[model samples]
Target: MTTIELTAEEMAFAGKIGFYRDYENKQRSNIADYDTKRFNLTSLQAHRLGVMCEVAVGKFLGLDMLKQPPEVWTGFVVSEHYEFNKGPDILNRFEVRRANVRTSPIPLRKKDLEYSAQVVQVYVPYTQTADGISVPTQCELLGWSDSVEDWPKAETPSWSKNGQARVVHNKRPMSDLEVMV
Candidate 1:
């Protein structure tokens, strides 16, 4: 069984930080009707969060690398609310709710394949007022998805409040056109 541990610094630097943004996707027909403004984090944040998730999933799955070098740490999904420095004193609140470490298959140019491991995480954030200021009091990680697109589509696990679990399977067949043509 793998036993992964995180140093203080490692834990601090890793994990996804949610940010606010305006989403503009013409591909979605319904998107045009509603105000696009929403809180969203960057893809980089999401990827980092995935790493943090590994720490938890590794423990759950009992993988062997949890004790080795280049130690794998699962990703974290963090939901946070930050108030203007002048307006609020609370910085953030977060929780690691669900984590998963799993291997994904990748195709090689030589008609071979390899398995790459990744972590997924999900969480939520909430804020409330205290002492005349809004403060982040809760942040939760709900679950994880191996791929970016699959992340949202994945289901949360039963253990999580809104947890839905998702497993990715890469089974796309390779075309032979490039092998000879």
Candidate 2:
């Protein structure tokens, strides 16, 4: 397994802080039907969070982000469309997830299995206090499993929570990961 180190400041500056701020501003704006403003906001937040994790993970691995296609960029990769690659787009490619028990199962459909990555990395972010203050803390690499078979089974149905679909499973604690920071 490959590991990389990241300082607190670097992690803090990567992804979604500003986007969320803008979102909050919109929430308070005097617009028609403001109650529906939260529409699709959660999914957007999740997507942004995933991108943030990918940025950190890619940086930690010492890979050049400029050379990689944006997470949603369309193009060819390994004989297939780049969008075909799900999860984290790092080193050997991985599916990134925030630390949550319900999200442990990797969703690899039968057809998607061929295009799926072998690693599943979960990142637990440091908390931001309500006082508008956040203690600088390193995002934890909760755990990873290299077993492709461990990904969610295609035939097994997934569950939904907060309007998001998730494959649930009991994952073993993160293995001994060696990070060279």
Candidate 3:
């Protein structure tokens, strides 16, 4: 496992794509526009940011996002609409979840099991400003159970505001987890 700590510049660059909650729907926006007018962004920018984060995580893990496994590479070759697939974002098979703070738990949807058999969780911690702009700070490889059955047992049941089933687990501490770069 490797650890990658993102620099202030990298994080700030990632912050260009931002999100906001409008009533029940979560809206995307450009940070620059938000700073001035707090306007929403097109779906294109949101999709691009998702790909960027995935690529950044893959690069940190030493995998070339363009030349990795078909599944991983396919994630990068997308525009307009984005597809949500099961498993990790990188070819190394570590399930990656990005959170606003280091202490935030990784919330894995109950139905997604594509990468549940994998034993490692690449938890990326990021920081966001008061206005909802954010940048990823660091990545940690959390060694979890290999058995998919163990995952549900390890997580605490919770429901999203929209009535979706989910589980959250704190797992190992950020300091104790191995760093992957």
| Winning model by TM-score | 3
Encode model 1's per-residue lDDT on 7-87: one tens digit a residue: 444444333211111121122332221122222333433334434443433333344322422212212211121122211
Error of 2 at 120 (Å): 2.2
How well is each residue in 20-131 modelled by candidate 2, as lDDT tens digits? 4345445454333222334223443443444455555556555544356545321122224444444434533454545433344543333224444434455544343555
Alpha carbon lDDT of each predicted model: 0.28, 0.42, 0.44
Q: Model 3 scores what on Cα lDDT?
A: 0.44
Off by over 4 Å in 2: 1-9, 16-48, 66-88, 101-112, 131-137, 152-181
lDDT of 3 at 34: 23
The alpha-carbon root-mean-square deviation between model 2 and the true structure, to one decimal in Å, is: 8.7
How close is every model to the real structure, measured as TM-score?
0.25, 0.47, 0.48
TM accuracy, model 3: 0.48
- CA error at residue 26 for candidate 1, angstroms: 23
Clash pairs detected, candidate 2: 88-94
**Cα RMSD for candidates in order:** 16.2, 8.7, 8.2
lDDT of 3 by residue, 35-75 (tens): 21221334433433444455566665466554554455444
Off by over 4 Å in 3: 1-53, 79-88, 114-149, 161-165, 168-181
* lDDT of model 1, residue 119: 28
Give the Å error, residue 90, model 2.
3.1
